[model samples]
Target: MRDYLIAFLTTGAITFVLSWIVWKVAIRYRLHPEIRERDVHKTPTPRLGGIAMFFGLVAFFLISTQLPGFAIVWEQPIRMWALLAAAALMVVVGVADDLWDLDWMIKLGAQFAAAWIVVGIGGIQILFLPFGSQVVVSSWLSISLSILAIVIVMNAVNFIDGLDGLVAGVCLIANAVFFAYSALLARDFDNSPETNTAVFITVVLLGVCAGFLPFNWNPAKMFMGDAGALLLGLMMASSAIVVTGNLPPQLLADNDQFGRSQLIGAYIPMILPIVVVLLPLLDFGLAVIRRTAKGRSPFSPDRQHMHHRMLDMGHTDRNAVFVFYAWTAVVSLSVLLMYIGTTAGWPGLYLPGLAYLLIGGVACVLVTLPPSRRAARVASDTKASS
Candidate 1:
């Protein structure tokens, strides 16, 4: 726990400092592209924030190796190196796209290549079924599913990087939730190196996002661009793969059919990582479908994202971002509570679940409320004077 806190703070501080440096460099180099019609921000902002985040990730891993509790990660050099290599590849691709617009095919190919590096080289493949009695999968199927999962998560996060602080905030919450769960698994149930690595990855992710959020929030000083978005997506997907793929086989066995059935019925944690980002996935799928139905390429850029819709429905920039954040928190925490219920029984479920529901419900209502009545009254009075 102490090591985790140290890792988080160290990584966050490094990323925060690096973010400022990157911002200045981007401005000096005139690295930002001209604002497009579909853009939400009026002013052009410096990008390449991902460069800072990538460095932060590297720094965290290095620092972790020196920490007594985290040093065990160093034993698995291949896995660590593979993740870094894939992240570097994505960063390069993202930086290129930010500097000079690349063709869609080139970006897509790069994503696939990075996925292959993680799954094939790092050996982080999804090998279990979250549902059904069956758990283990064939090697070919595991590899294929792992790649597909990585691609989906990568693109989902990239697609939702529409608002200032939106992606960063969402990723921070999602990673923190997963980190908590991973830490629990490692500390109590599974003290394996694999679980510890997952915790480390999540900590790194949480730190980078925390460090970057200040600059990326509303009235942004800089944008993360594709570089930050893709890198974040990759890290999140990698953590999920590492945790899920490395689970002890006994956890997934059907030795006691009734007990297994009961556990499976409530054990949403197995898929909690994916569920936490379901909003982005849903938005991405809808965008593709909406574009294809209009006889346009699925990748065609547009202003019809969930955030865009919020703006269209009269949400201010900050309000829209916060609304999305609240929804994500609700979904993530709800799933987390369900997982606790699965392991700790009904009493564990009711209190936290109800509290989350009440708080989340109120937050959603408040965020979704129309423009203030006070403001409306002032507008009417001004109209009358006119």
Candidate 2:
């Protein structure tokens, strides 16, 4: 834990400091693009903030390799290099797309190339699903599944990067929950949690998000654009892949220590990953469906995102972003608690997690919908504008 803290602090410091430098450089050189018709913000803002995060990620990884506690992670040099290479590739592609608005096919091709590097070069492919029993997969299926997951997550994260601080805040909360879950798994399930790579990855994610959020908040000075958002998703997916490889599905399923483990434990490993990115995935699915229904490309941009809907519900931009943060926290923390409860043989925490989900969900809906009159006015205004 102590070593992980060091890693987190160093990463946060680097990202935070570098973010300021990037903001200044971008402002001085007028690096922002023209404001789009659908954009909520009136003024152009720098979108190269992800460059700082990219550097911070690289800096932290290089420094950690030299640290004693991170020795185990570096033992397999190929995986780390692959992770870095894939991330850098995404950064390059993202920067180009952000600047030139590259065609969807070109961006997608880059995404596939990066995924292949991670799977083929880094060997971070998923070997099995952590179901009740290990559902082993063939090598071809493993590589295919891993690449698809990476690409899906990358796009999902990018799709929801509309509002100021939306991606950074949601991802920050998601990584915090994942880090807790990963840390617990490393601490209890593994002999030496100190050198565990998954925990290291999660903390680094949390740190970078934390550092970047200050500049990305409402009334933003900088945006992560495609570069930062894609980079974040790729790293997160890679971490998820590697963590699943370390998990013992059988241990998670067993009722040896506790009287019960069937309800949540058997599937929590798979569930938790999906839960963390639930909001992003929801938005991505909705956009694809909505676009395809209109006979347009799924990758086409529009103002009909979940956040845009929240605006239609009469939410201020800041309030809408907060709603996203809250939903992500409620869902992620609930599952994370369940994971701890089942793993620690504490039936008490597990049961309460269900209650937490119910209550938090209700609260989220209440916060999401405006009063009857407000909703009517918002509807009227939206119709007038359309």
| Best TM-score among the predictions, by candidate number | 2
Q: Cα lDDT of model 1 overall?
A: 0.84
Quote the positional error of residue 14 for candidate 1 in Å. 0.6
Q: Listing every candidate in turn, what is its Cα RMSD in Å to the true structure after a full C-alpha superposition?
A: 4.1, 4.7
Worst ten in a row by lDDT for model 2: 186-195
Candidate 1 structure quality by residue, lDDT tens digits, 112-206: 99999999999898877655543787899999999998988998999999899999999998888899878877765667777888898999899
Clashing residue pairs, candidate 2? none
TM-scores, all candidates, are 0.91, 0.93
Local distance difference test values of all predictions, in order: 0.84, 0.86
Q: What shift in Å separates residue 100 of candidate 2 from its native position after superposition? A: 0.8
